[model samples]
Target: MGKQIQLQDAAYILKAGWKLFSRRTSLETLQKDKQYREFIRHNEAAGRNNVSDEGKRVYAVATDEGVLFFSDSGKGMKTRNSYLQHLADSFFNFSKGVETLKLYEMEIPSRQVMELADNSIDKLAKSDLRNAGTQLRKSEFSFTKEKMAGKEMLEGAVCTDKYDLRPDYNNFDRLTKEFNLGISPRNYDVASLLYISENGYAGHVVADYFHPFSYEYEFRDLAEKLDDSIKARQSAPMSLHDFGYAALQMEAKVMARDILQSEFHITDGEFRLSGKANRTSQRTKTPEKCLFQQSKEPEPEKSGCQAAKHVSSVVPQKKEKKQLII
Candidate 1:
């Protein structure tokens, strides 16, 4: 009953509708990038007959759709499985820290994903560095082999673009998990974290830290947590990087403690916290507040020499532009 629209008019209308429906965003920033991707898909689709059993198609490591680009010069192969595995191994390394529990992991299922999304919609949400390795990426830091040692310890500058060092879905998983079985030398039973990197290039390492102890940074506040951080440092051997790691631990522990002290109306030189609050202890001492240790390096305690050596090997060796801050 309607007059037929011209084909040209129809095409124009459809194009406009497409544009409206698909607004440009971070993922759709470039037309060429997606085109290149489609072109590859088309060719691969046209011929699978010549493909061997071992041949596999790799998808880009991504947060969304178009954050990564596939290139041959990639430092590591672009894939979800390999990079995540490496990161998991690194995180689950019981050799470095006091293993409260064996780090175990399984592939996340769709149900968990949906549950997180549904719960997050109800709430406002919430939401390193390295020594060695070419790009010592961290949740908040980066450094190189050269910068990781001595008084010259330095963290590379932060990157502007969103780039993931590796994929780790459960950075917090290690904290809660516990070893059920009594076992010595957990070589095979440790867990892992898998991260899909930002630049599309993906690789992973064992979740190891510069500090040897399985120190946690999560505290109620800075001041409340510093005393415990200092205590943790006392457990560590004296080393070039150990000092820096200790300083970091102290800062995190102390910052939380300060907030707690404010709540209790406590002044300097007096500390008190118990129960769950005991997790974050405040230092009544002034020295605990100081971040820089005396230049006189602490002696290397040989009691845990094997553990210390193992932790040292996990550090990467590279000249990175800076620490990759997440």
Candidate 2:
């Protein structure tokens, strides 16, 4: 215990915090300290037993000010003094390499996302419904008229209101209790019908913007419930806007996977990229193109966002007629 106390005292003297290395004082000062003498005696005794008198190992110490180094080879002080410079050069090269190799997910076309989601819903809707009702009732999502055809269809996910158990009929109120939609666009509810077909998926991040009494209780609650489903590509302490972006990214990835296997030869994940679909119909200013090509009809404008739009590539196309081009 006495020896341990002496070693600890020596260590405390050497430990650096937000200060520089042992530059403020001289080695002679440390040698005069009682604990330092005891530590040196212990160290020398251990070294002699190991039959090692020469020094070649590099020892480094990190402090808030910077890193310091020492060599046991008893070499000149010049080499040890330049260790910080060498370390900085190596770190700079390492940082450059890391920046070059960083990977990023390509942005999906905002316009065509709606069409992709619709097609995805058409194929996976039945399967999704079965899984929800049978195995995952708590987080089960459904395909509603608005969800399948709404403008925000691709940017948001909606869960059923039946599981709310609360007597309140208000959607916002239910969200605060223990409910959450998979994801939604910024400044909009996951279940809201307004701004369903609006363009733009951009949003800004907010700090602790959804605490219980932050008037965004529902948003906070949903974020909490979705902790498992949401995966962020950025750093920790994500905001609501980050969640929205993550949700959109997740949906796009799923749709892209499905597209790879489908007949739509729009994108090959290389040259072709997704973009927004044009609102105006080139073929016949009709409401929207039907899912089935069998019987085409003039869709009612009331069902603005109820139909899946024909997706197109980022390249400009002739204004002759509405054609699916990638």
Candidate 3:
């Protein structure tokens, strides 16, 4: 233990030294960035596969270039989840990845998240449920539950709400917050929706600004309480507002597997995204498109967020209607 501690201390010193040296302190920093840019470009043209070091890698940023590759190779992968530590690192000031072995859940509910939705029932503001499908198909991302929860979570294989602790709900709360959907039918119970939809698939299928909370939620209730009847479907590929729709295709399969495995204790190998109807409707105004409302949708501009958006190629909860030509 003493030797290990000494080695870690030495590594820390070297790591800290590298960071300090890497800092762009002034105009000279800009010059160095130009140099790095040239190197990155040249490497790209040299036919290098975006092949990063594989195994278990955690990133400070999701974008490929910005991500920090890490490995817990010597100790065995599950011993400490370097990935979750990478995630929890954001919520905390520490540089080391979140020690999932340490945190049980990201946030424990004093009241079941169900209560949060219930209490806010009357207070949710009226916002549009963007149904008009936008083109989000060509976009893709690698999705997984984030790590910020404590130890039991890191060591465990399942990333359920009971273990994740990022929220009792899922990205629903985050989506609502980002778009500022001040509690109404539109903002109603985003967290609960997210919690239920975690392993299920969702992507940026469409965007429109209208007040359709009551309309959409009443018709498209987010969570499924053990409903096996909901057959998982994958429609023909046209990437319009594909987030939730595509996700449904995936999550349905995952949830189905979980139910069968845990409840029935079945280890069936015959599982895939099949046996569901895949209908492709001509791209028209989606269920979110409304004649009852006036379009106040503004053009979205990419405000100088160069590094943060690198990881999430698919902006799932975005309210923008314009397609970003990457």
| Candidate 3 global CA lDDT score | 0.27
In the predicted model 2, the residue pairs found to clash are 55-72, 55-73, 109-274, 109-275, 111-276, 149-305, 151-196, 151-197, 152-196
Candidates 1 and 2 compared: the better one by lDDT is 2
- RMSD (Cα, Å) for all candidates, in order, is 23.5, 30.6, 24.6
- Give one digit per residue, the lDDT tens place, for model 2 in 40-100: 6545544655542222222222221222222322221222223222222222121211110
- Give the C-alpha miss distance for residue 105 in model 1, angstroms: 28
Local distance difference test, candidate 2: 0.27
- Give the runs in model 2 whose Cα sits over 4 Å from its true position: 1-4, 7-50, 53-81, 87-326
In order, what lDDT does every prediction score? 0.26, 0.27, 0.27
TM-score of 1: 0.20
For candidate 3, the 10 contiguous residues with the lowest summed lDDT are 284-293
After TM-score superposition, the amount by which residue 185's alpha carbon in candidate 2 deviates from its true location, in angstroms, is 44
| TM-score for each of the candidates | 0.20, 0.14, 0.16
Output the lDDT of residue 86, model 3.
Answer: 29
